[model samples]
Target: MRQFPLEMHHMAPGRVVEWRLRSTAGAQSPGPDGADGTADRRASFNQDKHFTVAEESRAADDPTASWIAVTFEVAGPLDEDALTGSLLAFVRRHEVLRCEFRRLAGELACAPIPAAELALDTVPVADFDRTEELTRFLVERFKRSIDTLSWPLFTMGAVLREDSATVYLAFDHIVCDGMSMPIVVQEVERGYEALRRGELPDPAPAPSYLDFAEEQRSRYLSIDEHDERLGYWKEFMASGDGEFFPRFPLELGVEPGRMYSIVNEASPLLDAAEAEVFEKACLAVDGKPFMGVLAAVAVCLREAGGPGVYRGFMPVSERGRAGWGNSVGWFVNTMPIEFDASPGRDFEQVMASVRAGFGEMIGHLDVPFVRAWELLAPREFAARSWPYPVNFFSYIDMRKCPGAERHEDWRPTSHVWSAQANGACSWFQRDAEGLHMNSIYSDTPAARRTMDGFLEALRETVREIARHGSFRRPIALTPPRRPALTPLDVAAFARRG
Candidate 1:
């Protein structure tokens, strides 16, 4: 193996290089029984891609560092000369795209390694019959590819042009997250278009993902500021016992396997009315609608024959606070929330409890889920009982996808759903033509029916609350209750205050 420094290194502000692979040449060796065979590991980075720039900076907050990998591909009978010229030009224009990673001490980091720049090598095969073989070969090479610094992860493949032939590029996910793919893809398109048109690609002045990662480090690293927050989680997790409400009847560990079923239905209500109802319920509970919705779902779970404990994980995006988002990186944190159930509480009272629980958790949103798990359980109980029970529930917040505006573009798509049960199920909500309450659980018909009935009962409960302040009949099994508070009492209290 050999590496080449970038001849056009100074074209960008960052370091860039081209890495080349040496050929077997006259070094062919004897294989088993003294017969000659090719070395399977022979590969040249120069043949497929190049890097314009790279950095050696380590993530101050995380042990991992970051790097960028860029590759070029050509299609059809193959325009070798055009592809070569285009790739060379691309490496010269963008410095960040050509970086590589290295280990610093015990932690991974990135360096301006001109030695690992992308390059192309000659493959003597031209038969189109090896198309599948070529694709598989490229994907396999990518699987072995690494950014060493950034999560030490790799991309599957980045396909450039697939007219008659296909080319792919891959990178580790540490320096990038799922959200960053669109920007990277768009830049690739721009680079290819510029090369095809015989012009220098315009340099885009966006900050790299590394910058965003550094920002995350600053916000989450303050121990003094975060201690109170951490302590809150410690207390919250310690609040519950080892018992968790399971979606399945058996203990969570007894699962044969999880099951998935699809539930699609149309609500007579228009989108506007549904939104109104949700907001109204929130207002009825003092205007924290997420709490209202979650409480409703909890009620449904209670009716669905749960393990008597309502708990699940919810992901909160920390991108918008002080220094996140805008740049592409993964900064999501999941918190475990438990809902205490009693027949004595009013639906609104339950909603208020959920609202307060989540509000407190968000104050400590910077803690990672792994760390939270550590703080929440006893050393012995941590491994056996779930940090939170398996019956997870989240509202479907898919409004990010354009609504009726792109209805014509949608085709009937089917997806496999799986929620591993520790003797529980995972449920999520999303807004479609109507409400979509998706349940993922063990592959049992009875459990599925139970969930369906639970959903029905939930809707019924919500409707009752919407029309009347309480259930038509008081919970018959509850202890005798004091007189319920009314809207007049609320209004008079507000007037007094």
Candidate 2:
């Protein structure tokens, strides 16, 4: 480990005394007395500590880059000292924050480090005009690779402005998910507030991530109890046509040397009144905002693919269990949502089908996608095909979360790393402001066109819903008819022409 001499510099207003942080020694278990003479804290390293199958697959596919970033904008005079103390407290409360991963006997093992060893970095904001510089800094931060075997799987830093600052907590997806972000932020805020009042932050609720991990391992190892659920998935996979669902047809051929990139398209913000109407419409149909957005996607897919089954993946949280709601870890599992888009069916029918499919999937959510794939499909087939692109929909109402709304002004933003191999993925989040959607696809003209069309279709679907005020009845539609050409037919025609 590298050592550095202690140094002091002029402390900024309301700033904590800076400490020279030295790297901890190798992954050896700490002694009875921590480096600072504090009592040693150790978490067992076991097979249960290994990453989830989804996380393991993601890491194996792309280990060097991070796509998840949680940025918070805070307005008012900042207190660096209080913030540092709060962050340390927050880390100590969540074992996953102090945990790192290492390869042991052909498997990954987690090692927990003392929270005292973690440090926060503060970068001064020279001027408000340095927007480009700040963007570059954040981009570089997200692009930097995480050393899984190290003590920290995440990084925390602040871009300090005179009266306001932006605090960023970026992490590799392997350690956290979207649901975990708000919890982390809320805890940090509470910790900061407690420290500001010269009080120690309260202990986190029972059932930490380690506890959840053990429960997950136990459930996964004993599959006999979940035989019915497993059978349902196996049958579902087998019932599908031999061919995978079709990708959106691209007009132009992909360039030989083209690189992978993400293209994002979002609908205009729905104002308070407009959002109200949309919410009412959703409730009228026994659906939530997520169902509304998903219904729109289903409509678009029906229009794009035509008279066939459409398959996509949705990530559901397992935090509803007792003592698990507030736990910070990747307690999310991906489940398949299949909708049969018959040409004769109307929008209402399509939505009803979607709602029913979603309900059934949730009922059987205990079976992890990894295990389903292993039991239902061949290894070669799983490796060669990207069967389930994700459709992520979340509603984050900060008003309900304590401490989150205390700031004069704050906004949350997220980004995911994109790769060509991953294919197309869509995410939707509805907050107080409005609805925001981000879609990632390959950086090709054809890909862009397909995405643009899909967004247009989604907007049209939402407008129709609002116009009708309820999804109880089918919207206007023309007589059912087949497309002039399938994607394959179009490709053949393109080659011949």
Candidate 3:
């Protein structure tokens, strides 16, 4: 028998209940081929999906949790029974929610839990004064470590107050991504309305995540087609210098049992008018908005690090396949983006180069990053070091997605997990207010100042493009020498705090 650790914190002024999920289906014995008997009883994820499952399984105790959470504020009438029913219905509609990872023949495999054995815990709160405490409780609940070996790696609960109730939904990253949150919200809302009206919600026509995973596995297993792409990746990694990015000067020496704290700095990159001009400029160069922004980031890195090649990780969505766009699952694949911003190149030329590189990467998206790493790096070297990208970039435009609008006057907000382990990550969001960029970095003092300067440099680069319609002239670059911070600077910063 295998057991997984479970932790729950209940802060509301009510009784707390815990439910243990069990499979109602009978267990199967091993077959003649020596394969695990359950292999035939469970649905399987593709190679890429299994990669994430394996990763989470290894880091089961990691305090840096992998979860996606969304909060919804519902005002006016509150129907507790209807909401509970809706949530259960939502769970039954998605196959991924009923699945768990199990060890089969020395490998991790996913199998569905019987619906009759599924469990949901309820906590009734009566005090409005406990709002803050309840919020923290739910946040911790959402951020709590997940046991991937257990079925249904998701939780749904509500903190009911007199005037309003806040619905909190958390899903393990192994089963969902950022794009899946809105879909889940929509379904929950639809289910709630239908249940309130004494009717069952109509099922969506979207394909199951399991089907998508099976297709992905088949495509990735096609050795003849992927071998050529693997060759390209091996060559790409071989051509680059094997050195990691330079560290910030303020980074202290590694201390025993010390975890790196991540800090985020946000800045308004462009106003609505400036964003319009930036979009027009990108169109003039036959580039996309993200490409234009990436060009600016490359310039920032080149200026700071003294040019060579700036490589970063960019996540590519695999939902482009027909009928898979609406499926809720982990369908993102991270790929490396290398930019050569050598001195003496005009901004237009840089944009063209970036566009070309992006086109080439799109052509070879079938090759997974882990497979390429295994083929490219030596075994001994791989054991000693992690080949994570020095920088990461992600962009999201909520306006472009359907069913993302406010529902029934309820406000919805998404809280994404930070990619601090990657050292530096920049997320750009396009909203009604304007264009905003948030840079998350290691918490060293030097990293903070550098990120501040980096944001300023990014703004200046964009402004230059907007003003001149191109980067015909070279922009000023920061010197490679690290700046010395005096004691007075630290004292003053602390005083300001």
Q: Point to the candidate with the largest lDDT.
A: 3
Residue by residue across 180-212, what tens digits does model 1's lDDT show? 333333344445556667765544433443444
List clashing residue pairs in candidate 3. none
Candidate 2 Cα errors over 4 Å, as ranges: 1-64, 116-129, 145-150, 222-227, 242-259, 264-269, 378-408, 419-421, 470-497
Considering lDDT, which of the candidate structures 1 and 3 is the better prediction for this target?
A: 3
Candidate 3 displacement at residue 400 in angstroms: 1.5
- C-alpha positional error of residue 414 in candidate 3 after TM-score superposition, expressed in Å: 2.0
Model 3 ranges with Cα > 4 A deviation:
1-64, 114-121, 125-135, 221-226, 242-259, 264-267, 306-308, 378-385, 405-410, 418-422, 463-468, 471-497
For 1-497, candidate 2 gives per-residue lDDT tens digits of 00000011011222212222233554455444544454433222222232433345466774323346665555566688887777666767776666655555554545556555555554443332444454554566556634344446676766665675556676665567677777777777777778888898866543567666656655664564247777657545555554233333333234443335555333343544566677787777777766776766665666675335656667777778657677677777767677765666655666677788888888888776655554555442345234433233333443344344542244444455533533566666655544655555666666665666666556656766766754334433332332221111111211231
Candidate 3 structure quality by residue, lDDT tens digits, 373-404: 54445352243124332567777765554455
As for candidate 2, its clashing pairs are 67-417
Candidate 2 weakest ten by summed lDDT: 1-10
Per-model lDDT? 0.39, 0.54, 0.58
Model 3: ten consecutive residues of lowest lDDT: 1-10
